[model samples]
Target: MPKQTNVRCPNCGIQFAAPVETVIDVSQNPNGKMLLLAGSLNAFQCPNCGSPVRVTTPFLFHDGSKELLMVYVPPELNLPKPEREKAIGDLMRELTAILPQGSFKSYMFQPREALTLQGMVDTILQADGVTPEMMQQQRDRLSVLESLLGAPEETRPSIIEQNDAKIDTQFMQTLSLLIQRMAAEGQTEVAQQLAIVQEDVLAFSSFGQTLMRDAQEQEAVMQEVAESIQALGAQPVRADFLSLAQRYAGDDQRLEALVGLIRPAFDYAFFQDLTAAIGKAPADEREKLETLRDRLLELTQAVDAQTQAVIADAAKLLQVFASAPDEQALDGLIRENVAVLDEAFLSVLLANLQQAESQGKSDLVAKLTDIYERVLGVLREQMPPVLRFVNELLGAPTPEEQQKMLDENAKAFGESLLTTIDAVSEAMSARGEDSIIERLAELRAAAEQALA
Candidate 1:
């Protein structure tokens, strides 16, 4: 992701700033294509008039799997040769730095420069074998998707049924992609609508049934593999795993999928059992077992390396957290890693905090506590303020006291606050605290009536 920056809107001739990605390496960020499809990567809407603006700043797009390396430069800018080369050189450095070494091909050194934003987008689609006919079909699918989404509730289903030709496996996938993007950008309402439409498509379309069946079969394969392991006693040997693999190896993809699903189980003792079995097996059987071991090794090593990289990064983050001299800086670092503030990271952080507390690092404990607050504060955005006020009103010891407090804080009640209340309610429901969710609704209703 490139830094958010200012750009001139050609439609309205207004200057606005937005997040503009300049170097999109799909190998690094797999969602780059969705961003491109959603027209968000270089998309900026004019602030003054809400007109669409394509900020065709220089960008280097890459997808290693497709052998795609394309760049875009605004013709209007007419940048000098030396300046263009310098920009390209810097982008090349940034791209290569993120990618695996020697993955760069000679074609990459001469990225095809796009004259227009559509041209850049077309270049990417073409890399994925999207022929002109396919491109037109995609555009048609997009138009139908918009029509169904924008249609009135009573007519939406009819529109969907009429254009059943438009709704395909690819159409549902496109909707899924858009939903992912919307949710990521905090456009929850749009994401929710798209999700409903996607479900309708899945329930009504023919290709949807085929897709669903395929997914079910894939899931069942893993589930059967998991269940079959029960036949192996609590302490199963390498022989047990080999039997399981032999049962599934008829379909290699299924075998790999099973391996991936049960990857965590392939720890030290599991390998030790396999090694022992290899030693005991006769020549032909031993060779077969050895190959199976190698296959598992290949699969597990690939995944484990990725996990190890995350763990290592988490470890480094903990180190940074430990070294923060003040609470504010600690909060800053925590905010930067909100998406990665997951179980793996939080568990590691807890271990670090425990060490700090055990070592009499009271100051560090206070900072960690602040970090925890900020982490929750992300989910807790606009939540705690309203929730706290509601609680205070609820427990003011009397109805009169509650009313008095509500009167004093009347300025804080608005649609924005109501939206936050609903948001918090959703969060509380997701967390399975329905009891509190009921209270939230009651509080919001009271606030809404009072404001009315």
Candidate 2:
């Protein structure tokens, strides 16, 4: 829980009441932990002028799992020595009062002190496995990014060329994360600027070019492998997968794509059959088959490992959401982690929902359903207007309903709706979603007629 504190906005010179978080317990209040890490805890936008205001006060940080306890008091407050000691004592008492009996430890009595907010944040991140060196490197990358963004458009290419060595994979990932965070925080202009900077980096940096090429090639390989699997008919057996593996034996990318697309097909029986085939092959061909088997096994293991990592991360995020105390807290969590509320997280949430339904947990089901709807609402709001309109049209069950939606939005969408429909139809055709492609074709005709 946050303490309501009166704060004066520096820009507006108006005072307002704001919720100021004083205690951040990771296990009990993960939202506070997240906001603190994001550097937004106790930060508020002035109601009158929307200027950012930060409240600095003494606070206690505790992570029971890590056995870490610390307290921070801003030196700018300039309280007397006795008063500072009294404030710290008061915060410590507050922390202990909320904690369960018998959970108190020696460390709680002698809490570590953090002189600065950054120092506290660094300590928290270090506890989570991020080393000081990694933090410094991230800071350096951010510095480079800022320099690039601040450079004139005509000079950006030169700046990128100079910093090309620094703009590696991790730098690109950092930039991407910043873009997503900015967008999630509703800093549209900043996000758009960062996006332009990303494009500039991609255009001028050598590593970026290689990454783009690899992504394009991987997509092409996946599409080709998808077509091959589709050609195997509705029911592809172990033998069919084995044949596909053999066909893509020398091409590592294709083999990886094939295994990724049909991972469940490469079970024990499939491997055993491959081993048997390897044993029966001619002496000269046996080595090749054995190598193919080894490669398939490696690909399957890698795919499984990657999938498990994704699911584990999603599950952890879901736990954070479940631990949120109320709707407002959950909403804050959703906004903070919107970048990671991807398909994997949604799948995990849906699985939990189903399990709760099967167990007849009506309260949990309702809560989870509300979370699902809220997440979808936020995602829909983030979509481009044209895309959102198309999605709404698709959700309509019947032609009449779809037509009614189209009619209502036809003037708003204008000619762009038909163009968007054509684009979606092409994408659906490439993915071999025949039914969706057909429906998109119908939507396009109706849209064109309406717009005409």
Top model by TM-score, which number?
2
Q: Write the per-residue lDDT of candidate 2 for residues 1-452, one digit (tens) a residue.
A: 66656789888799776667888777778868877887767766565664556788899999999999988999999989999899989888888888888999887878899989899999999999999999999899989989987888999999889888888989999899888767666555787899999998988899989988989888888888988998999887888888988988989989988887778899999999999998888999998888898888899999999999999989888876776676655655576677788989999999999999999999999988989998897788667689889988888989899999888888798988888888888677565688998888888888888887
Cα lDDT of model 1 by residue, 221-267, tens digit: 65666567655766876557766775664466666776775676777
Worst 10 residues of 2 by lDDT: 43-52
In candidate 2, which residue ranges exceed 4 Å CA deviation? Answer: 1-57, 62-69, 75-83, 90-109, 123-136, 151-155, 404-437, 448-452
lDDT of 1: 0.70
> Global lDDT of each model?
0.70, 0.84
TM-scores of the candidates in the order shown: 0.49, 0.81
